[model samples]
Target: MRRPVLATLIAAAAASALLAGCGAPAAGDAASAAGTEPGSATTPAVAGEITVLAAASLTEAFTTLGRQFEAAHPGASITFSFGPSSGLATQITEGAPVDVFASASTATMDDVVAAGAAAAPAVFADNVMEIAVPASNPAGVTALADLARPEVKVALCQPAVPCGAGAASVLAAAGLTVTPVTLEADVKATLTKVVLGEVDAGVVYATDVLAAGDTVTGIEIPADVNAATSYPIASLAASKNPHLAKAFVDYVLSGDGASVLTAAGFRRP
Candidate 1:
């Protein structure tokens, strides 16, 4: 018989189990059900932990995903180290205890693949760039072209990040050069500038704006600019819980994960 359920928030923790040398591939999928191990019952506390190093832009969606994973598989703990994809890659190369590395840019993951720190990575979701403006619209910025004005204080991520690269593409396609007041290390930082009213305008992923929940208004850039963004995830070479890692990664591409990402305004890759 199924045990009585508790007050689990679904996105709270992760479930870890011991089943060496068995089961299906869970790479790039983050959603796994309880009893993933052989003969394992849906126990209240399976007791396992998986560490994930992800890009800064994925902070919200992944956090939601984490909570869901924890709820589905009770007794599991998921720890995340979210930051710029490049920084995460460097940490992995330097031998961090990272079971999964989800990069905002393929180039960053290439570094991990080059150093043999992670297995083959896969692109899971795609994001499009948008104009993030203050909730009050103090600058009167309405369109992508408006960002070219002198009075608009803009912000963009450092060029090493995926969102930054996409921002450059958008500017070049429109033949516009924005003198951003700040070049943040990650997309989330850039978005924060607009949300905090520190900048009149900024560029960020469409998903970022949605995740912010009305803290900022988003204007669609161009479809071509959207063409350049992608999110890739992989399993690290040094993992104590690889089976669980794969389960999480695989969940990322499943229908449940796709729905969460879509609701957050990210497109399927």
Candidate 2:
């Protein structure tokens, strides 16, 4: 009887050991199944998409900055909407799903702020007007005065845009008034007219001229007569991704982003 009882006890112990071996995972298996290494510190994932509405003048610089921002914050993406600052402001006011707004002029940003579409906007950069002419300079436009030539076809941004207002100010400061053949919607459109030879000359932002490279020749406007437009950036109040929007605004104001903008001919504000 004692022998039989001992054998039964040994059999029970063996069965319990087999169950334990089957239930427990092998070393490192637990971590692998959990999608992390053993003893590794966990980090919060940074992921989301934010849409930004920016002025046309900021196209090149902002595009570069947006790429850098995405690289720095893995899993984050940015979609940009570029147009005249005034048009962008109106879009935001009309309930556009924009996470951020970067304007070519403070006045345009003020409009968004006044409409409760954006919060306190910070001036990020400044840009001045430059005379953009075709590479061939068909109308022989070499200075601000040259744009007044009767035969010269000049293009200027619409008055509703910051570029247009700046152009008006520069022309006013020079005491010169010349009718434009076309009123473009934005600085890029004005530059395009000059680049495509649709117009002999255009008044556009200095940055736009720089972005055009050799496609268009830029005649520097006299500092005294040139109108400097202050660029302001802010996260919109209607942002779906408020945190990501604010992060993008902060990134734009960072040193790395400033370096990119400065390289693109934007002056530090």
TM-score of candidate 1 relative to the true fold: 0.81
- lDDT tens string, model 2, 1-269? 36688899999999999998999987577766765566652522345998999999999999999999999888799999999999999989999899999999898888888999888899999989999899999888889998887899999999989999999999999999899999999988889888999999999988889999999998999998989989999998888888788889999999998999999999998
lDDT of each: 0.83, 0.90
Error (Å) of candidate 2 at residue 221 is 0.8
Judge candidate 1 against the unseen true structure and give its global Cα lDDT, from 0 to 1.
Answer: 0.83
- lDDT of model 1, residue 41: 43
Angstrom error at residue 165, model 1: 1.2
Worst 10 residues of 1 by lDDT: 12-21
Q: What's the C-alpha lDDT at position 148 in model 2?
A: 82
Displacement of the residue 101 alpha carbon in candidate 1, Å: 0.7
List the candidate 1 regions with Cα displacement exceeding 4 Å.
Answer: 1-47, 225-227
